[model samples]
Target: MKHLYTILFLLTGLLSATVSQTRPDKINVILMGSTHFGQEGFYKQGPSMDLFSPGRQKEIADINKQLAQYRPDMILIEREPSEQHTVDSLYNLYTSGKLQFAQLSYGRAEQYQFGYTLAKQLNLPQVYGVDFYSSLPTRLMRDGKNLDKFIEDLNKFSNLGRSFDQQLKDGQLSLKQYLLKLNAPETLQATYYNIYINPARVTDGSFGKADKTVDTARIDKSHIGAEYISLFYNRELKIYSNLLSLQQAHQSKRILLIMGQRHAAVLSKILEDNPDFNLVPLSSYLK
Candidate 1:
């Protein structure tokens, strides 16, 4: 009887431990893909109007109020991890009412326009920069060896949403509407294909042998295009790694990531496959 009682006590303890270890909820992450409100980088030809204009500001604020419903524990932006100190410093200044929105150099950028605004509205500690940047050996494609074909391959991947950009430029679609179109599932999937997938199709590396100018050391002889896109793939992988580290450190259950529409599309696919993260669709909160 004494031995049986001891065995029962152990079994009850094991059951309790199992219950404690079972997690009912996965971490919620909103991978928001956004255009550069600053009209910078590859989007230098973005909408002509100013983001700080009264109309645009109101649209952005509305988006923020909607997102605030998610009550994110952390806001992640497209800045480099190395820039975390700078991000924290700037956020502190903004939160303390010391940094005017107009004073920041990248103030018009989405990091400030959407990210900082939401963080301040929610009174969160600080925003995080989880971006990773690496230059591609694009020169491999520009070596005049099948350059025409390379250009053709790239032109095949033209933006499907150019009309939306035009509408935004012509004042037809409001900022919110334009963003919703951009984040729509079809749009993101198309973005992933255009920006990441299409590039890999440029696999003809036969130019290496004919073009004496080509640096054989760096260029992949048979898979030049795939090699070129690998850098982009690496950067995304690094950014995902940074998010994992941050999640572990903060033990955050809800995270909001603000990134370029391209990154958003790619990271969304990745986060969807990740077991620990519940990648919440933007339509859930944004709408």
Candidate 2:
């Protein structure tokens, strides 16, 4: 009888492990590209511009149609984790019908801010932000006071130059085109690597003991291609880690992530490396 009891316990442990390893129903993700809903140039926009332009409204409707079909268990956004309170407040305002604007302003702040509202409307779980925000002190440390001043000055200049609608439209530019327009040379790649890796080491006070044998010289190029590539790679790793955690926590539920278009390629590549995840692009539903 004791021997039989031991056998039963072993079988139970094995069954639990098997259940943990099993995949959920289906995880669907969408990497959406915004176009300011066909708004004008970027330099002239104000805070009061329409949030959901007509084109954007149609897009959201179409996406909603997809959501209804997919019926995902959760929706995740690309917002900073620290902005949860602001997002929650905005969502409340939206669902309460207190947030109103033109019909065509669907992609505006008011519109983008409606992500939580949409999640609620779909009757899905609360939306989550998968990224972290840098604190003010950290930002100041990473970027000098001059850099902060420059960003402030740039924002002021931009606001004075163009309509808010235009600014939204500008954000729609593809990653490649945007980088090229910035005139970032290949050499900037090394600079970015140093910035990213050195900070962690410095902050941890482990710079003296960290591995310095690997030569990053070859990867540092002037077109800044390496930097761009690294950024995307890091982003993919972050998403993968989060998805893995979500998978472990909710063994039976599906998770849907909404991110920018630039991340699609890198994420697709990363997914290819992990056989457990079956990734389905949003484009598949459009047809």
Candidate 3:
């Protein structure tokens, strides 16, 4: 009888542990959009801009406020994975208190400086650039290595840059828009060629030995300038899957994904197919 009682107690303990491990903790993914125009009044006077303007400071403050509220375990950016070194350098500067910004007008230097500041203030662990880098040869390949194609590519990039600049002026573009634009179909294709294909050609040392090949089938299914959209969707799904797995493994932490406004629609649709996951909108926090 004593031996039987001991065996029963051991079985009960094992059952309780198994049940605890199988249960999942709620995972929250929040996708917040930010205004890249920085804070209002960040720039003052004719054609001159202050990188550290008051408005920019305010924008950072707002972001910081949100960070405090969310206390995210990780923050992901739309940076290219190849730019990891640059990312690491920025991270070190931020965490070591060696990062600082100066007042300036017009250009990427200011924007990047500000990004560094925000990442630092939040004490973010690692910043992941989920996008691919653009390459020159890839551009040539996509455009059929012709002058006309080159010109068209240039025009597109120029136009996008202008549109984004205009949005900054109008205060209409959010951080989400700024990031998504880089991964836009045309932009993504151009970038993929630049990073992936161009390098392959360079190694072969054949700049323009043969005619550019177009995969009509792939284009048909994905469409021109939309392949990156599909890639983004795919990546998001993988991220979601990883989050789910993590939840199951720990059964104690929740996940929140901060994504662009464009993703909200598709992500919601995708989640519908996956019954195990739940999709909650930012609106939940708004009210």
Q: How many residue pairs clash in each candidate?
A: 0, 32, 16
Sequence-dependent TM-score of model 2: 0.49
Task: Pick the lDDT winner.
Answer: 1
TM-score of 1: 0.80
Task: Name the lDDT of candidate 1.
Answer: 0.77
> Candidate 1 at residue 128, lDDT?
96
> At residue 56, what lDDT does model 2 achieve?
46
Candidate 3 accuracy as TM-score: 0.45
Q: Can you write out model 1's per-residue Cα lDDT over 76-188, one digit (the tens) per residue?
A: 99989899999999999999989987786567888998899999999999899999865443334544345566566445534455677777878888888888888999888
Per-candidate TM-score against the hidden true structure: 0.80, 0.49, 0.45
lDDT tens digits, residues 1-287, model 3?
99999999999999876543222433444443322333334344212233355664565465445544544444444455567687777777656767544422322232244344445666655655443322222233242223354445556655765576566556575433443454344554554443333232222111222232333334422232343233344555664554454456544232344343333334445554665554444333332
Q: Is candidate 1 or candidate 2 better by lDDT?
A: 1
Arranged by TM-score, best first = 1, 2, 3
